[model samples]
Target: MADFLGSVWWMIVSLGVLVTFHEFGHFWVARRCGVKVLRFSVGFGRPLWTRRDRHGTEFVVALLPLGGYVRMLDEREGNVHPAERAHAFNNKPVWQRIAIVAAGPVANVILCLALLWAMFMVGRADYSATLGPVQGMAASANLHPGDRITDVDGRPVQSWAEASIALTLAAMDRRDARVDVLGPEGDDRHATLPLGQLPAGFAEQRVPELAGLSWGFQQRQAIVAEVSTGSPADGVLMPGDRILAVDGQSVDSADQVEPLIAALGRRGGPGMVEVQREEDRLALELTPRQDASAPGGWRVGVAMSAGTAPAYDVRAQYGPLAAVPAAIREAGRMTADTLGMMKRLVTGNASLKNVSGPVGIARAANASAKRGVDWFLYFLAALSLGLAILNFLPIPILDGGHLLYYLIELVKGSPLSDRVMIAGQYVGLALLAGLMGLAFYNDILGQLPR
Candidate 1:
């Protein structure tokens, strides 16, 4: 329930901030272009709070929080007084109209950059881009376990998050990349990975795993997380107890305890199980039970630690002035990646599953928020970039669509006929509806058990 509430709260916060900033760009530009602002609203539906400025523009914070819009006095939308005709949005010069229409996406891009700057200054904590197991493509490329990736295609990377994006993009483009790594023996090695050779159904696998890479062999302490009721382990072992050994054999990780306990069950004798229980370490006599349902044909009836995201092994922080270049570079990289993803979609090289809806956004927002402010800012930056790119696609009823109209008007010295414009709006609505439907479908599929 807390998670659900957190997801809801963060989703609202994320959307509200993005939407308000986007609309403000249009409002600010429109007003500068001499258009009469009517209502400036964040969200839709019933207004929660509203104030009218001296200029009669009503500013509102509404209930929905999903999206917002800036309404301007336009001759086409409503009858404008003849005295106010010069202030109508439709009366603006073609270039001014283009600027006003383009401002929304431009604002989001700025916001992306700003968020990234803040993230870098605050420092992003993450695990190293180290390989645990290597096979298939990674193996063919001569990569090995414990090899720490440092550079890909000339770009240096410090974390799995950055390396994964670079690698995923390479795979999508079917391009081979020169990779630099620090091997297990502390030797520097370089290899060309055949990212192009990934199978067509690679989308079904996590990018790293699809490319035959594991973050690292994460070792989990053999602390019992749960014990089944009325089972042998229920009384013999309790949650939070760390198993030290089974049948007199030492076991340190959760993965190591299973085999030893199963061996004891097969031997048909009681064994001394050593466990660390808070302040005490003791040997207790216990016998494992045979159960077909258990792995290895024996049962301990206790769940071990399943592992978790590793704590930050490194920090990517810099001074405010120093973060400028890094932030700009990140912004440029994000833009390129977003564009690349769209190209993959158009070329059918990517699955519709890659497209996510609000459900996915909510999950990401909640998860990032839990990580810390820096991580959340990073997430917001990426989401902002995506929003900017999406709004700039040359489709009708969007900012880019509006800019398209103005560009045609500029070339022909006349506006498109109302009939033609209406038809375009209809086409745009259909296209948007279909796109949104696909996103929702993907979101639902993601929730279903794999």
Candidate 2:
């Protein structure tokens, strides 16, 4: 219940801030263009709070905190007195009208850049890009344990977060990526990861996991957390037992325990499992059984949690002056990535599951907030960038649609017919409804256990 309430509250807060800023952009530009701003509202429905400025513009905080709008005096919407004719939006020059219409998305872009700058200045906590083990594609690429990824496709990555994104994008494009790595022995090397080799039907949602890479610092200890009844380890292992070795081979992480257990099955024998129980070290013999459900067709039925994650091993930090350029670079990269993803979606190269609705957003907002201010700021920046991208899409009923109409007016020397515009509104509404339904469906589907 607390989590549900937190999600709702944060979602409201997030939308409120972003929507207000967007509306203010339109209001500000319209005023500068000599258009009479009639109302500046954050959210819709009945007004919860309202105030009128000296310029006769009404400022309203409405009941629903979902979205907002800036209403300007327009001859099209209502009558305009002769004295106020000059202040009507419809009377403005085409260029000024374009600026007023475009300002909302432009504001979101500016906000995105500013938020990224603040996040960098505050230092973003992240996990190191150091590898613990390599499997499948990663192993095929010759990545070794303790090797740290320094760069991907000529782009330097400071953390696992950056590398994962770079690799995931490559995966979506079915392209190989060149990487620079620093080995644990202090030697530098270069390799190409065959990210394109993943099956076409593979889910991009699990890209990082199936990419056969695991971060070194993130590996859990070999302590058992659970034992399934009637399984190989049920009678032999307890929850607190820390597995020290399998068949006399020392184990460092829980990931190491599985392979050794599988080996015991192939060898057709019960194996000596060495463990540390509190202050005492003991050895016990246990057989690994074949189970179709277990990895490598073997099972011991011992479960382990990553357990109280370690402190962040990396940070993306920049000084005040340096953060400006860093923010610009980050925003540019994000924009390109977003555009690429949209293209992929259109081309059916990406899944519809990537489309997150309000539920997904609320959960993300809450999670980021819990992580830290820097993380929360980063999340907001990314969201703002998405908003900018979404609104800029040349679809009907959006700012881009209005901009498109203005462009057509610029070329043909007049506005589109009112009939055509109304038809476009209906088309846009249908597209938006379909998209919202898909997003909500994905959100619900994501909640179910895989």
Candidate 3:
């Protein structure tokens, strides 16, 4: 129950900040455009706390945190005093009105940029784009483990995060991407990865495990760091023992030893293993045991220490001036990726399973908060970008919908008919309801047993 409450608290705090940032943009712009702002509210329904400023603008914190609004004095809504008529929102120039309406989403983008700037300044651990042994379809490309990926489709990538995004984009487009890698033996080579073979809607998955194109930082040496008690490795393996081979197969790296051990364990027999300890080669016989967590899989219950792991924290901090452009580029990339995802969803190229509702978001908020402040900020940046883009989608009952009506008014020199506007509102509500229903369904489905 405490954990559940903590999750709810974080979710509310995060959402509340974003919502306030969004609504403040509208309120500020509306006031600047000589419009009389009636109320600036965070959330909806009955106000939990309300106060009117000297300017007669009511500031409110409402009961529901689902959404918020900035209510401006408009002549169309009610009668305006003759003195205040000139300051009404509808009486303002169309350009000014457009600015006021567009400010909310634009504020979200700006907030995202600021958050990303702070993230880059703080720095995070980044792994080199090194391949950790090829498997499955990737082996067909003749790419070997320990190869450092330098670029994808001529675009340079310095880290695994960058490579993953670039590769995912290429896969989504069904393009055969040209990947260049520098091998361990001082040789550079290029391979064409057929990303089209990926399953449909695969890109929609966060951190999709691509079938062919896979890479990771160099693995630590297969030296035992810990031996689980009462398991297969309890008596047979000891910490600091460097595993040299299993079943006469030479193991050069840590990544190769996992499958080798699992294979031997599955055979349900004792296996001869070679290890090097203190400059002496030792032969040991040990039977592997099945791991309960991984059914049909076997394990020796040993953990490997990270060798040279500190070498991968490639932090590239930027000055205030430089961070601005970097932040813009990062925000733009995330925005484009989100737009691509929405496009795929609408076109049926992506599955509804990708949709996340409030519950999933709350869980994510809780998880990110536990990771650290930097990660929590990263989550906020991404979420802000998503909210900005989603709010701009051309649907009624959204900011984009209001902008659409305004645009039509601009082109036709008159407001849309009241009856037509009402119909659009109803249609928009229905569409939003359906989307929310689907999002909630997916969220609940994710919690059920697989």
Candidate 4:
């Protein structure tokens, strides 16, 4: 219940702020263009809170927080006073109208960039591109655990994020990812990771996992971290005990210990465990316990003392002069990635599960909030970029649709017929409803236990 409420709160706050900013963009631009802004509202449906500004513009917060609008004085919509007819939205020049319509999404993009810039200045914790264990083809390719990935092709990667980006970019051509690494034994080597046959949207998903690398930055030692009371490890093991072997099988990493314990539990037998405690090698017999969550699952109820990953600073701590261009580039990259994903979705190459609705976004907000303020802001920045990208899609009933109409006007020297525009609106509404329905379906399905 607490988790549910927290998610709801964060979702409301996030959506409210974003929607207001978006509506404000239109409002500000319209006012500047000599258009009379009648009502500036955040959200749809009945107004929850409202106030009339001295300029006679009404400000409102409505019940439905899904979207917002800026109602302007338009001669076509209503009978405008003769004195204020010049200030009507319909009376404005086509360029001014375009600017007003375009400003909302542009503001979202600017906000996204600003958030990113702030996040960079504040800095966030990150880990180096170090590997733990190689498996299957990764081992065959001579990629070893404990090797630090220094570069992909010629591009240097100081952190995992950079490394993932580099690898994904390399995989774009459906070829191999050329990676340079420095081994634990002070040896330099290069490896080409095969990328062909990877699933669609692999760059956004699989590349980060490194495709069967089964690796971690810091090698996990076979030392016990903690033991849950009333469980198998409670009476048998203590923290700081270095696990040496299970049933005469030598254990190296912590990764090798669990499977042996699980097997013994499933077989319903005791296993001989050897551990080094304070320079003493002791042998003990222990039986694994059945996990309540999974009927057939086995557990020793001991947490592994996994060491912290090697650290790297991924933030761009740039000056004001440099931050703008950097932010712009970052925003542009996000835009391109979104468009790419959309293209893949249209081509049926990407999964619809990737489409997150309100539930997923709320969950994300709650998760990021737990991480820290910087992480929460980072999440918002990404969402903001998504908003900008989605709104700018050339679909009817969107800012892009208005822009398209303006372009048509520019070419053919007249506005699209109102009858045609109204028909387009109905079609656009249906399309949007279908898309939202899919998003909601995915969100609900995702929340359910698999």
- State how far residue 252 of model 1 sits from its true place (Å): 9.8
TM-score of 3: 0.83
Candidate 3 lDDT: 0.82
- Candidate 2 on 204-288: residue-level lDDT in tens? 8677678788888777889889999998888899999999999878887888888888888888889899999999999999999
Candidate 1: Cα lDDT at 23: 92
lDDT-best of 1 and 3: 1
Ranked candidates (lDDT, high to low)? 2, 1, 3, 4
Looking at model 1, the pairs that clash are none
C-alpha-based local distance difference test score of model 4:
0.80
- Residue 329, candidate 4: alpha-carbon lDDT: 72
Clashing pairs in model 4, backbone N/Cα/C closer than 3 A: none
Query: Best candidate per lDDT, number?
Result: 2
Who wins the TM-score comparison? Answer: 2
TM-score of 2: 0.86
Candidate 3 lDDT by residue in tens digits, 32-86 = 9999899999999999999999989999999989779998888889999999999
TM-score of each: 0.83, 0.86, 0.83, 0.81
